[model samples]
Target: MIINKFGFRSNVKSVSLSVMDCSAGMLSISLFKDLLKVHKNSVALVLSMEVVTPNGYNGKVKSMHMANILFRMGGAAILLSNRKQDKHKAKYKLQNLVRTRLGSDDQAYQSVHQQPDEAGKVGVSLSQELLHVAAKALRTNISELSPLVLPYSEQLQHGWSVIKQKIWFLAGQKGTYVPSFKKAFEHFCTHAGGKAVIDAIEDNLRLHKEDAEASRMTLYRFGKTSSSSLWYGLSYLEAKGRVKKGDRVWKIAFGSGFMCNSAVWKCITNLDPNLRNSWSDRIHLYPVEIPEVCDH
Candidate 1:
């Protein structure tokens, strides 16, 4: 419909995908790369939209109720091209992408699911095991992604730590080292799914509060915009003038079916500090104190 509305040629191609919410952005980039392989100099539009307002459920189920509190209606779009003329003006260059899925496991598969209730009214369900499943998915994704992004020194440290942790396990010990991804990427665009999600990522990665500021602020301002949440986080970094020329950025997201996807990008040039973005009007008020919310 977009292509038709734009009055594009009939030969222009389009594809729609629904990989849950979080990983859709990276998945769209992967799909665009595949299109480039088949059609040289191809231009692709990656669009992500989530309409959670209609999915809101008023039932008494607590887990299901959280979704209404977390998700919000939002969308984002990006244009990609292999054309020589467009390359000069591109903001960033894709470096690497890694995806992990644990759908084979029953718990992982149903961690975040949509189904009917006792009254046969359907709604999205959030399992108590959702966080556990997300952690597993992230570990699997990092295992595949670390080698592609982390420097050699960090990799050696990470490898030695894993071995030490295994040996410690045999000796009845219970601690493991967390390698610093900050050494690998200058900026991180973690999914702004919710406050809890942001907290978990920061804790697991041993990241400083400033490192997670963009994600936290994005969540506070935008709620959980589903797949587009990562973009908002990245936009936050840009708006703060944190991203620099030649800097590497790590974008990570989690979706239903226990999927974790990551994308690495290198900034092509230094971005203007005053770059207008979604948060232009209120960027000054952000990095604000986000107090803990306990529902007990």
Candidate 2:
């Protein structure tokens, strides 16, 4: 049934995004962008999803337990068109995308990992140190992306701050301000990896409560949908009737390579509010407060 629904073709190259952390979704979108560039007149369907339960492992490993508690099942399919005519009917236009990978060291990779225990159940374990790694990567990614996205005033402040601190040695390596992605994009679909991650991003980016609400709501209601979490956030926006023609949307996701990936898209058409699978269906059941982490 699954095969039939997907309509497998002999010539299609099936790429599976497995074991990648939350950033996998942005990576998948970036891949779609590249494919569209190559197949300029063709249509491309991109699928992103993850199965967290299947990878759950039973062990005393505290790190793996974090994964067991964090991940949840979800998937998304996005259709892209490269034909110039598509501009008239398209729902969104592909804009700039940037991806940055840090922590290539073995220690960084091992900091977050999936391993099996005595019972032989495969599960993911994330070291507490992963937070530090994530922060470092975030800084690196924002540094590379900010100049491209930030306003000149903010960039100048960042530059002067670095110089004042006498950190000239790190001049090009510091990120003093988060890009005003919200200014450039009317909507944001940040990956709902966890409450802490979401909060950290919100604080770092100085996003308003409403700006982070969609991601937090999705995380609470659906848990971590891995690569598809951002779509769920987009669905939330659609449910609220916020997406409109010419509105730009930004998607940001983090993953295993200690990677940070971002995609910018401009909506071409107004989305119907009656769309099925909208996030509103489960919003009523979401906990008003973030739920306590379980040790399952």
Candidate 3:
């Protein structure tokens, strides 16, 4: 027990929490929500920051250089409370959270790894198998999450497809059906990992180009802000006046553990188009056409 500057004695809970590697933003929110459950009517603040120093990498490996090219300094702070009084002012409600990891597999664990080069200069080396590993992790996460967030009709269709796929496998054929996430979520905020990553998600999830516009714009404008990329994508939607009351959003992210994590949020208030935020000043210039390769 201790007394704070406010002169009130209370228990201060301190936790050294981390999910290991990136995606710490989502991990922090999960932990914060869990802590709130333990302390009723409590408010929790989750702060996530990433600072990429110029000296953090020293290598000529093309894979490693990709990190330096994409990673940048960024941070986000989110406040959450379970207090009934705060409900009226709350912007969204957390509906579901699902985390998946393949760290036990060697390929997954080494997908995004830090090590020394031949010159003994340390830098993060991305494995050539990263995309494959990431896809598996995302699939596993969606399998667990779909039941929780998707509509019953969608789930039934997906289940039937899986059964048909299994039968086809017995016949030495391949078939799969990708469930439509758009039916359940009005907005999709995926991590701005890279253009390839964003494109893969948009294609696999059957999302339209407009649905991935926020993520593509974030990657182009802010680079890869690591754990906070998802928030920036959400902010892009907010600034564009795309979010509305009763809208459901799907926030997804992938990280170093070869992990995929997702959270579902239901909007409680209609957002204002004129809302000032990180993207407000330049929202008009977004959804720009990014050529296959830019040389200018």
Question: Each candidate's TM vs. the true structure?
Answer: 0.93, 0.85, 0.90
Please give the lDDT score at residue 117 for candidate 1: 78
In model 2, the runs with Cα more than 4 Å from the true position are: 1-9, 60-63, 118-121, 167-181, 280-296
User: Candidate 1 or 2, higher lDDT?
Assistant: 1
Q: Per-residue lDDT for 1-296 in model 1, tens only?
A: 78867898888777778645677878889888777878887788888878776677877666667777777877888888888888778899889988888989999999899887787767788888988898888889988988887788888877776687678456554565567899988888888877778778888888888988888887787778889888888888998888999999888899987799989989998688787888899888778886667211
For model 3 the local lDDT of residue 200 reads 87
Query: Top TM-score: which candidate number?
Result: 1
- What clash count does candidate 3 reach? 0
Give the poorly placed runs of model 3, Cα more than 4 Å off.
Answer: 1-19, 59-62, 168-174, 294-296
lDDT of model 1, residue 233: 85
Candidate 2 similarity to native, TM-score: 0.85
Give the Cα error of residue 234 in candidate 3, in Å. 0.8
Instruction: Give the per-residue lDDT digits (tens) of candidate 3, residues 1-296.
Output: 11344364356564545435468888888888788888998887676767788437766766677667767888776778899999988889998989898989999999998788898888888888988998899889999998887889998887787787678455553556678999889999997888888888988898999999888888888888888888888899999888999999999988887789999999998778787878989899888998889411
In candidate 2, which residue pairs clash? Answer: 23-254, 57-123, 63-125, 63-126, 64-124, 64-125
RMSD of each: 2.2, 3.8, 3.4
Record all residue pairs in model 3 with backbone atoms less than 3 Å apart, i.e. clashing. Answer: none
Instruction: Write candidate 2's Cα lDDT for 1-296 as tens digits.
Output: 34468787777655666666677667767777777777768877777778766666667756567776777778888877888887777778777788888767665676677667677867766767776777776677777777776678878876777665576666666455444656666777776777778777887777888888778877877788888988888888787777888888777788886677877778878788667765666644543565477311
